[model samples]
Target chain A: MPERAEWIAVDWGTSALRIWAMRGSEVLAETRGSEGMGQLAPEDYEAVLLRHAERYLAGDRVTEVLVCGMAGARTGWREAPYRAVPCTPAGEGAVKVPVRDERLKVRILPGLSQARPVDVMRGEETQIAGFLAGRPRFDGVICLPGTHTKWVQISAGEVVSFRTFMTGELFALLAGQSVLRLSVASDGHDADAFRDAVGDAISRPESLGAALFSLRAGSLLEGLDPVVARARLSGLLIGLELAGARPWWLGAEVVLIGSAAVAEPYREALAAQGLAAELVSGERMALAGLIAAREVMA
Target chain B: MPERAEWIAVDWGTSALRIWAMRGSEVLAETRGSEGMGQLAPEDYEAVLLRHAERYLAGDRVTEVLVCGMAGARTGWREAPYRAVPCTPAGEGAVKVPVRDERLKVRILPGLSQARPVDVMRGEETQIAGFLAGRPRFDGVICLPGTHTKWVQISAGEVVSFRTFMTGELFALLAGQSVLRLSVASDGHDADAFRDAVGDAISRPESLGAALFSLRAGSLLEGLDPVVARARLSGLLIGLELAGARPWWLGAEVVLIGSAAVAEPYREALAAQGLAAELVSGERMALAGLIAAREVMA
Candidate 1:
């Protein structure tokens, strides 16, 4: 007989789903899918989880699932009303869903919101919580680079204030749908081009509008390479984000929690500005976060 | 039979083709089509124009066709290399394409390019040329808002300097393709929301990233109306454009040339900033510019 399941850690977002079979602090098995909240109806969440976890499930064993991200959104499985910020980022305020199956006990964690600046985050809070669990005394800015990149402030084990930037979404749209698509390559990087664009964007941030259109003009006038074009586009967008994030990152000890692909550019950009930033593997943080949330479930 | 064409004025853009059947300075008839440069091969341009102008091409006599916009692009009918800046926006150095149809004489006019800021505009140059012809001695800024908005400066019949902003494209992408698309509406505008957003964006342009995400957050947390969401998005983008364009529009005699629908927001934005500007019909300006360019042809 297989070892009985203890609990599951799930990160259910709009477009992707990730789950780890966990026993205490150790992850036993992991699985991910495209069956995220956007692709499933409210009633289908239980079945979908079971289908992906077939290999890990044991006969007649009840499994506790700790969930985060859009699974708790109004459009997701069930609405977990946001816990307004100045609160700890953790398993607290979780919403319990009455599942049809007796074998599943699911608790979806609540996201954090700021009332004054009017900001909110779904998945990154759990990652922040996990980072905090690992480094209890650490207090500074945590940069989470994703579709909506976030800069979070932490003090006394609570999320103080945070801001979100649409840098990644802008890059994706421009690279795929905008005129720059002709000049942008799918996979390449030019360090020199990126560094120069970052410098220009920070000093003359308002030039972003004119500079965006220049990708086409430069391609037409100077035959600019696609790799350079892609790099410049990425650089300009990130540089603009940094310009907005200076207050949160300049004097603070910054740590970037994201995939190597996304976090590397931010680390380089922060370094160019004379700041040393540490990057932590986002998968580890996410699994740790979900595990931490599960330990507190009823 | 329909009246034979005296001259044809064409605005062959990326996705649309527009032509005016004219005699002297008066338009006898006007027709436009979606068969723009994007939909045609180099050899296919002559046939497409002939098909669309069949009603007016009654005689064996060659009808002069004055063309502008991407029809002069390298990928269009024939290449008309851009005219470097600090020159008059007109029939200077137009490229003549040898046509298969004996009844047509086609000349594609050149677009304007700036070397320093690295900007370019194709069809807007024709409108600016027409605006300048109507007010020959008038000297100031002419704002042409569209997919790619242009701000042109004229002094003594010469386009002294100019800049282009990708405001419209950004709006389309953000509202149609990004995460904010869930909250943005197509057919509504909140005047108060727009005015206030414009004020905030102008004062703190760097806050654009956070402000954009706030559209979704506000929708989730505060039940934001889609119309208000759209207006805020538009206001923030245009405000950013204006912030970059402060050097061109401030203290200048500004004229807006475009379709009423597209130019209305710009006019309101300028008014919100306490600027009195004149509005001109883009079609009329384009026809005038083409007529003026035809007069220069040998």
Candidate 2:
């Protein structure tokens, strides 16, 4: 005998996919795959989703599927239109997709968009919803860090305005692909070096570009440690982001929603800047957000 | 009758090899190939030089070869150690590479390096030499923009100090490899958008990361033109470089060495800040630099 899955929840992005077998507001089982939206054709998405969720399926009964992120993008499985800003992050406006398997009924949730300053986010909105569900009266900024780190303002339980930065992506390119690659290692960092770099960039944000090349120069001339080099690179980019995002988090209570590894730096950097940031697990928030959406759409 | 080769000038970079056939100080014929340092082995560099200059080979007599750039890097043909900063850019101490063909007598010129801020430049030293030889008394800043844009301070005839920026490389990655690629065109620009972006970054350098993402959001929300997005991207990076390099060129005579395409935006941006810039052709500078090096080495 196997546990029956009442519904399915998915968070899909450019590189990977994660799914949860939900029984009402509770998750019964969890799984994910590398068959992300980027590698899938419109017709290929259904098969990947179904294959990954097969083990959780108990019978021929229909499994309500709720998805957020790139699956709703225009180039993804099916186009789920965006819900404009100043609105709740939910599955209310989710668009249904016809599936070959009668056991699968899917709805892709819409992302959020701002018109004036021009900003958008997909899967992170689901985490925002989950964070809001646990604290409905929460009114502050939600800093969601990833490849494209997003800083969103919430007032009276609705998203007011938001901005995104390419900090993580920039670090990846500089460390792994740029000329700085030879000077930096994949892991290990010096805390003192990270702190010094943070202070340097934050104090003089103008020197960011020159400081980047200095990593290579430092390695060549002064025998700078590779660990310190990696740490300094991370510190510089994050410090630059902190300098830019000061307006959003200056005197405000912030909730950081992301993995421990990614969120830790923001927390440390904020602390270094004299701010307290509350932490939330990105995975759990995604799950909670999906379960909440299922209650409205299923 | 075939032309005789009295000398050879070669620029071996990471991606391309260019050589000029010279009779005394005048170039007789010039040829280049895609056999860059990144694509060839240590032993493969000699064959490339010989084959490209085969037409200029005369009576098996020793053909004096003067080379610049990455061919002398540790990973290149044979490492020609770098000369410390606050020194004249000369070929007097260039390392001679032993070759199989007696017809090819090669000496790879040493690059310049600084200890404190940690900076180095290989091929650009030759350009600096060329510029100085033509205008021996000119004293100011020499800015060479490319994948790694270099800003050098020349007091008298020596490269006193310098800094390098990853601006051009960042533009290439963001415009071609990052998510911003979807919203940017290859070879088009909006000058007005470019100027506005430059002013924005120059005045508020901290907002660079956020402003980068705005390009994508603008496309998604306001139908921002791809050409405008491309221009804005270039302007932002260059403006950021200028902000960091203010000490080098502000209120001082500046010389820009590069192609029209690469130097155009820098020129415009400098003009925006009330700084007039004199442009120099990079190819001619390289040839002149080689000629200067040959006069010493030959």
lDDT of each: 0.87, 0.89
- Candidate 1 stretches greater than 4 Å from native: A1-3
* Sliding window of 10 residues with minimal summed lDDT for model 2 chain A: A289-298
Please give, for residues B242-280, the per-residue lDDT of candidate 2 as tens digits.
999999999899999988899988999999999999999
- Candidate 1 residue pairs that clash: none
Candidate 2 displacement at residue A23 in angstroms: 1.1
Q: Write the per-residue lDDT of candidate 1 for residues B60-102, one digit (tens) a residue.
A: 6888888998999888999998898899888698989899878
The per-prediction i-RMS, to one decimal, reads: 1.0, 0.8
DockQ of 1: 0.75
Range of the 10 consecutive residues with the lowest summed lDDT in candidate 1 chain A: A289-298
